[model samples]
Target: MRDNTRPLSPHLQVYRPQITSILSILHRMTGVTLALAALLLTYWLASAAYGPEAFGRAQVLLESWFGRLVLFGFTFSLFYHMCNGIRHLGWDMLWGFDMPRLRITGAIVVITSLSLTVLSWLMAYGHVGKL
Candidate 1:
C-alpha cells in the first residue's frame, strides 16, 4: 500500500515578511494570547473563591520572574492589539483601504505599540525604583 502525504505549500522561504504582513500576523497572534491571559484573570478570581492559600500561591506565581516576563509580553500584546484594532476599525469605517495608506497605518501601529510598551514598562519600573 502506498501512503500519500502531500507536501506542504510554500512557507516563509517563499515570501519575505513585509511590515504589513508581520504586523497583521502578529495582531492575530497577540489577540489570541490576550484571550488566554484573560482566562488567567478568571482563574485567579476562581481561586479566591476556593481559598486564601490558593490565591496566595497564585499571587506568588504572578510575582515570579516567569510571571513578570509573561506580564510584559501581555502588556506588549495589549498595546499592539489595541493599536492594530484601531487600524482595523478605520478600515471598517471605509478608510485606508488603499495600499499606501494601509502600509502607513501598519507602520504607525507597529511603532506606537513598541513605544507604548516601552513607555509603560519604564513608568512602572521608575515608580518601583523610587520606593
Candidate 2:
C-alpha cells in the first residue's frame, strides 16, 4: 500500500523557506551553540582553578585568532538566542502573529542581536566606554 518513490509527507523540498521557519531553525541552532560555548567557558574556569600554568595555557588558547573567532561566534549566538527568546515571549502573549508583524519582528530580532554583539565586542576590546 506504500509507494517507495514518494515522500511520506511534505518536506523541505516541497516548501519555500520562510522567515518564520528560518528564524525557528536559527533559534534552535543558536541554542545548541550556546550550550557548546558554555563547555568552553567551563574549561576556562576549571583551568584557572587547576593552577597558574593551566590558566596561562588556557589564556593563550583563548587569546589566539581562532579562539577569538569562536568567541565572536559565541557572542553572536548568545545575542541571537536572547533576542529570539524575547520575540517568542511576545508570541506567547498572542502578539506579532500577523504576517507583516512577524516579518518586522524577525528583522528587529536579527538587527538588534547583531548590534548588541558588535557593541559588546567593542566594549570588550576597550574600543568603547565601559557600559
Candidate 3:
C-alpha cells in the first residue's frame, strides 16, 4: 500500500516562490516585528514616566545610528502590516482572488507601505513640510 519511491507531498524545494506566497510570509513576519517593536515603545514610555535622567538616556539610545535603524525597520514593518491587512480585508470580501489582481494588489501593498514609511521619516526629520 505504501510506495517508498514516490514523495509523500510537495516540498518547498519543489516549487518556486511567488509574490503571493512571499507577501503572505512577509505579512506574518512583520506582525511579529510589530509585537517586538511594541516592547521597545513600552520601554520608551516607561523611561519618560520614570524621570528626566531615564528619559534622557532613552532619548540618547533612540537617537543613535543603530537605534534609528531599528526605528526605521519598526516603522516599515508597521506600514507593511497595515497595508497587507487591508489586502486581507478585500480577500475576506471575496475580491482580488484572480492571479492578475492578486499580483497587482500585492504590488500595491508593497509600494504603498514603502512610500508611507519614507514619507513619515521625511516629515519626522523636517525634510518635508509639517502637516
Candidate 4:
C-alpha cells in the first residue's frame, strides 16, 4: 500500500551535514575498508605459506608505491574504525547523546585516529626510536 501522493524523503543533497552524520557514515565505510584490508592480510599470509616464490611475489607487490598507498589508507581506516568503535560502545551504554558531548567525542575520535596512524607509519619507517 504505497502512497503515491506523499512526497519522497530528502536525499543527501537536501540536508546540511553534521558531525554525527559524518562520523556515522565514516564508521560504516571504515568497517568495509577494514574487511578488505583483512583479505589483503590473508593473501599475504597465504603467499608466505606457499613458500619463497609466492612470498617473493607478494612482497614485491606490497613494497611498491601503489601498495604503500593502499597500506597507508588501510592503516588510517583501521585506527579510525577502532577509535569510532569505542565511541559507539560508549553510546550503547547511553553516554554522550547530547550535542556538545557528541561533537567533542567525534573530534577526539578523529584526532586519535590520525595520531595513531601517523605514529604507526613512523614506527614502520624506523623514525620512532626504541618504541
TM-score winner among the candidates? Answer: 4
* Model 3 lDDT, residue 131, Cα: 42
Clashes of each: 0, 0, 0, 0
Q: Residue 106's C-alpha lDDT in candidate 2?
A: 98
What is the Å distance of residue 48 in model 1 from its true position?
3.0
Give the per-residue lDDT of model 1 (tens digit) for 1-131. 76568657545457788876788789889999999899988988988998999999998998899998998999999999999999999999999989999888988988999999999999999998999
**Per-candidate TM vs. native?**
0.79, 0.86, 0.86, 0.87
lDDT at residue 115 of model 4 (Cα atoms)? 99
Which residue pairs come into collision in candidate 1?
Answer: none
Q: Choose 1 or 4, whichever is better by lDDT.
A: 4
Q: What is the C-alpha lDDT profile of model 2 across 1-131, one tens digit per residue? A: 97799767547567789889899889999999999999999999999999999999999998899999999999999999999999999999999899999999999999999999999988888953544
RMSD in angstroms between candidate 3 and the native structure over all alpha carbons? 4.4
lDDT of 4 at 85: 96
Tens digits of per-residue lDDT, candidate 4, 9-124, equal 54556768988888988998999999999999999999999999999999899889999999999999999999999999999999999999999999999999999999999888
Q: Which 10-residue window in model 2 sums to the lowest lDDT?
A: 6-15
Give me the runs in candidate 1 sitting further than 4 Å from their true place: 1-14, 127-131
- When 1 and 2 are scored with lDDT, the better candidate is 2
